[model samples]
Target: METLRQYRENLQKIYGKNDYWMVPIFRSLFSMTFLFFLSRYLQMTGKLGNPMVILSLGLLSFFLPFSFVPCLSGIFLLYYFYTQSILLLGVGALFFVFIFIIQSSVRGKYAILIAAMPLCFFFRIPYFLPLLMGLTMGLSAVISLDLGILVYYFLRYIREYKDKFSTGGDLVEQLDAFSGNLAPFIKNKELFLVLLLFTLAALAIFVIRNFSFNYSFETALAIGLCLESTAFILYPAVGMKMNLTGELLSFLLSAVLSIVALFFWHDADYRGTEFVQFEDDAYYYHVKAVPKKKA
Candidate 1:
């Protein structure tokens, strides 16, 4: 236990010392990934799909603050949407405006959740958002997670039905079509089940992390993975008709990604604790806390 604690502390120290550089690298990587997937999803061929835009944005993201990356990505997405369809552009703009209002009202705390939406779509790892948010953020993050899911499904629906909207129609017709596309998402039992599973997983992680034990993060992750895996397995059996293998594969990948994210989160949040030692006149203090190992 001492060795594990020391190792974790060392890892945290290393990260803390280099976070200035490391953060930009991560931001750039995330930006590039988001752009790549966005282009592919939007079918932006020719110059639009060229690597130049991605590389340029990645370089720009590296130089810009982390907060700017999401905004930059949003601009890129809007440009793509405009090129595709004015209706899509309008809807996308309104959606993002709503997100902006929410974030502004909340002091930008849920920005990461908003950013996670694109990555979730690209990686088929929407479940990780709730898990991560639940562990690191407050219950309010549930709202962001839901909004992210809504954006994802909406974008997907647009892609699938882009052909139907190729020819411009009356505003009422377009609105009706958009509303129709939303029905399945609202009514689909599978989607709601997935959302419930994520909420429970996040709540489970949050609860475990507060258990006054060592390795709480790991335990939380393990429990969350089990919960998610169980849901994936049982979803098809309950008449969802999903592809079990694909679902499992996505879940496994998401779990791995979530673990990596948690490592960084743990290190960032707990880095100074190991070296924290202070004493008042009342008592001399020494502390070396160990995380609880799984039973």
Candidate 2:
């Protein structure tokens, strides 16, 4: 009884903290405004046809609440091919336009990639391109918000550590000293690992197919999940200064894992069984063993 009371008290303390949720709301608002301005520039200057415009458009629409519109619409179209395919497709296209509208509110280039997952899933689009889109967008927004929080904490740390600095030149000199110490840890190990995993995923997609390893919607979805989760878990770590570079590193690992998951799903034969189904107004799925793996 005493232990239970203590646990409940701990839970109350943790739940009482409300500031964590504020950054995401702020990020969404900021990113939305950034996208509006960017789109206006592109459309007015008539540079929307350029490849850079594609990236810019992606940045604009990545963080909005309505960003998932095209994704849901596309999924509906696929599911209701007999009735609403055309209408759903048009809606999906419009949603894509919105995604292009709010891209820049985030800070990192990679965050844009994270916002494109739902679109790929909705439209049955294949390949790592959409994964790239969602990750870039999500990462960008996450990094911006995180950096602001980090700066606040860093300022506090400086105040407490003021005695450690000997002279007026301490700010730059101390920061440089700190950077020099941290340089070894940021030597691209995480980046290389992530790229290697992605490369393996690409190879698997090509090698796993009978005649050719082809990219599929499953592949994109798998990778997107991995990447998003990576961003999710790593963001707080970065903000807390627990592992400054861990977010990027973990994201890379997550990306690779996602690719591998996609391959597994691809290789598995569904045997005409539906992976997801709605029954009595509730959605569910039937999990089946791999036929070849059955004893």
Candidate 3:
């Protein structure tokens, strides 16, 4: 019993301080929720491809925010250049050129941004909202992928570089021997509590969706909020132990909850919202009875 306790303590020490516990949990929950629901939404209308394609979609989802940072900036600069009386096109183009330089330099480390760039306009959402939504969604996605990448490399590195870093066993031997070791537990009791909480959250989502069809927007927003908050609370503790499966499941559940929140609890129309351009080159839309006009 004491040996198990010490082993768990050593594992925790390797992960970090107690403060880090929430990192894995929250990250898994949020990333999963965003990817699952968003994919489901895309799937319903036949816009999505096969399951393998959809499963891989989260890989593209993570970098949308970083890409949006440049995309939106570029868009705004272009708008200002054209709409206002300014010879800013050359300046804006130059700025984007610089951005490309930075992007290329960091491309190996931040390749996800390149993938998310095109997805910004795919939803045909309001310009600002897409940027915001894409970012929130992308954040969870990126962090989740990063965690997986870090875990794989960390495990591999501990094997290859173990002697250089520590007086422990030969790196390769240790790594090859690790699979036989019992998986480390972050907080066994706490995990059960969290799982129960997630189950309850799932139930809440189901009840909401059953009665509501016009819920996509609210669902998206709610899941975004929940995942973000929970991630803030859990990712540190769970770390890489919170694998892709856990992340995927949490995200899917959150998406369902979000859908439920939107249709059953909130008032919004998911269909028949037309993007109408008015005489003064302004656009307005009304989904059901909700009025949305451009500034």
Best candidate according to TM-score: 1
Tell me the number of clashing residue pairs for each predicted model.
3, 32, 24
Q: By summed lDDT, which 10 consecutive residues of candidate 2 come out lowest?
A: 118-127
Better of 1 and 2 by lDDT: 1
**Segments in model 2 whose C-alpha atoms lie over 4 Å from true places:** 1-111, 114-172, 199-295
Error of 3 at 272 (Å): 11
* Ranking 1 against 2 by TM-score, winner: 1
Report the lDDT tens digits of candidate 2 across residue range 139-169.
Answer: 2443322222222233233333433332445
lDDT of 1 by residue, 32-121 (tens): 887788778868787669999798888898887655766887798788777766777887798889877766655355665666765786
Better of 1 and 3 by TM-score: 1
List, residue by residue over 78-142, the lDDT tens digit for candidate 3.
44333322323443365456545555543333433332222221322111222232223332333
What TM-score does each of the candidates earn? 0.75, 0.23, 0.23
Q: Which stretches in model 3 have alpha-carbon errors above 4 Å?
A: 1-182, 185-215, 227-292
